[model samples]
Each structure stands twice: as C-alpha cells, then as structure tokens.
Target: MDNNYLIIRIDEQQNIELHYFWPSSMKIKYNYPTCITIHFDNLSSCFSLVSLCYCFNILSTSHKLYIGVEVFKAYLSVKFSQSYIQE
Candidate 1:
C-alpha cells in the first residue's frame, strides 16, 4: 500500500489497533501490546527521524490523536462503501 498514514483503532479496554506501512528490508516484531513498528519503504535516516517525530507529535496532541483517527476512518468508510471498479 502506498499509504503515507497510520491507522489506529482503540477498544473499550484501551487496547489499541495499529497498522502501518513498512519498507521491505526491515524486520519488526510486535512485542508490545500498545505499539507496532513499521519498516519504512526507505531507510533515509533524516526522513525517518523527522517522520517519527512528526507522527509522535501528531498522535500526542490533545484532540488530533483521537479525532483525526475517527475522521480518517469515517472518510475511508464512506469512500470504500461502494466500489465497483471497472477494469
């Protein structure tokens, strides 16, 4: 997937769901229940660091962390609701 975003789903117990895109060369294991690691499509050190920090900031914001996710989900729900792709 060429998605440049992360998807997080949270439940009643605060258990979180996360899905992210990873590059091919990296290996990762989901050892932590609350976190998931993504192997980026590129190994650009500067890019990766900046992106990680940026996402962390976005996810830590008071409302962006939750509201943004809900909004993205709703958008996807509506977008993929009816899909009859013509070949």
Candidate 2:
C-alpha cells in the first residue's frame, strides 16, 4: 500500500506551509510512520547562512535535515561581468 506523505515548505517570510499528499490506495502503516519532506525554497534569497543554521538548530529536535543549494548558470553569468578591465 502507498504511504501518505506531507510536504512542508518554508517561504521567504519564514512562514510554515503544509501540504498533504495521500494516494487513493494509501493506508496508514502503524509500523512505518508517515514521512515528512521539507523544501526550503528560495532560502538563500530570504535567509543568510548563519540564520539558516540557527533555524536548523531549532528544527533539529524533531528530525534530521539536510540542505542542498542549486545555482543557475545564467545567474552566475550575470553575476560575473563580461567586460574585463585590468586595474
């Protein structure tokens, strides 16, 4: 039987949003507890590394969390100017 899942997203404003996903044939397994997945969307834009660490510290009690950062090539190109000026 499929397992029910919860998706939690932390917004730019540090608001907690919850989403529930349950399949039609899903059944709650007492032996296997429901799993929760957290997605920190636009976290870098909202919180600095230090703040993110602090946030994680508070959340560490309930579950173990891992963070992954994804950067776009376009963003990198824009951040690095094409014009070369030697000082």
Candidate 3:
C-alpha cells in the first residue's frame, strides 16, 4: 500500500494551507499568527513553513529553521530513492 500524507504550509502572511493528495484530494486554507502553533492530528503528515522573506525574494533574516527543514526533506528523498533502487 502507498503511504498517504498531508502537507501543511504557512505563507509569509501567516496564512495556513493544508494539502492532502491520496485516496482523496482536499485543501483547507486559513490564517494563523504563527506557523509553529499549528497542530496536526496525523503523525505521518509533513509540515512546512514559508516565511515572507523567502517568498518576497528578500534575504532570510534567519536560516536555522528553513535549513533544518530542507535538510530533513533531502534526507527523506534520498532514503526513499535508495529504497526504490534496491527493490
């Protein structure tokens, strides 16, 4: 069976959007003050935050969080790719 997942994205304006594509498709959009405060019931879903600086093409004032997420995503991609290659 394929793993079903959801993606939560927070825009620069603090708008939140939930994307799900598997078994069914749905999108829920709203506004939230902080991206970190958002919660998800699914333990297998992926969460991401998009700061305004990056969206507006401005130099990000902070890199710690963004870099961390990028690294994690890259790690997952590599792991998944390797698993498929081995099969």
What is residue 46's positional error in candidate 1, in angstroms? 29
Clash count (model 1, backbone only): 3
**Which of 1 and 2 is ahead in lDDT?**
1
Per-residue lDDT of 54-76 in model 3, one digit per residue for the tens?
32123243433443354354334
Q: Tell me the lDDT of candidate 3.
A: 0.34
Q: Sort by TM-score, best first: what order?
A: 2, 1, 3
- For residues 10-57, write the lDDT of model 2, one tens digit per residue: 335433333434444645453333232223344344324423443233
Candidate whose TM-score is highest: 2
Q: What is the lDDT of residue 82 in candidate 3?
A: 27
Model 1 misplaced regions, further than 4 Å: 1-60, 82-87
lDDT of 1 by residue, 1-87 (tens): 221344554334323334443434435463222234323222234234434654344443543445344534533433455322111
TM-score of 1: 0.24
Best-matching candidate per lDDT: 1
Residue 51, candidate 2: Cα error in Å is: 30
Q: Please report how far candidate 1 places residue 59 from its true position, in Å.
A: 12
Return whichever of 2 and 3 wins on TM-score. 2
Q: Can you give the TM-score per candidate against the true fold?
A: 0.24, 0.26, 0.24
Q: Any residue pairs clashing in model 3, and if so which?
A: none
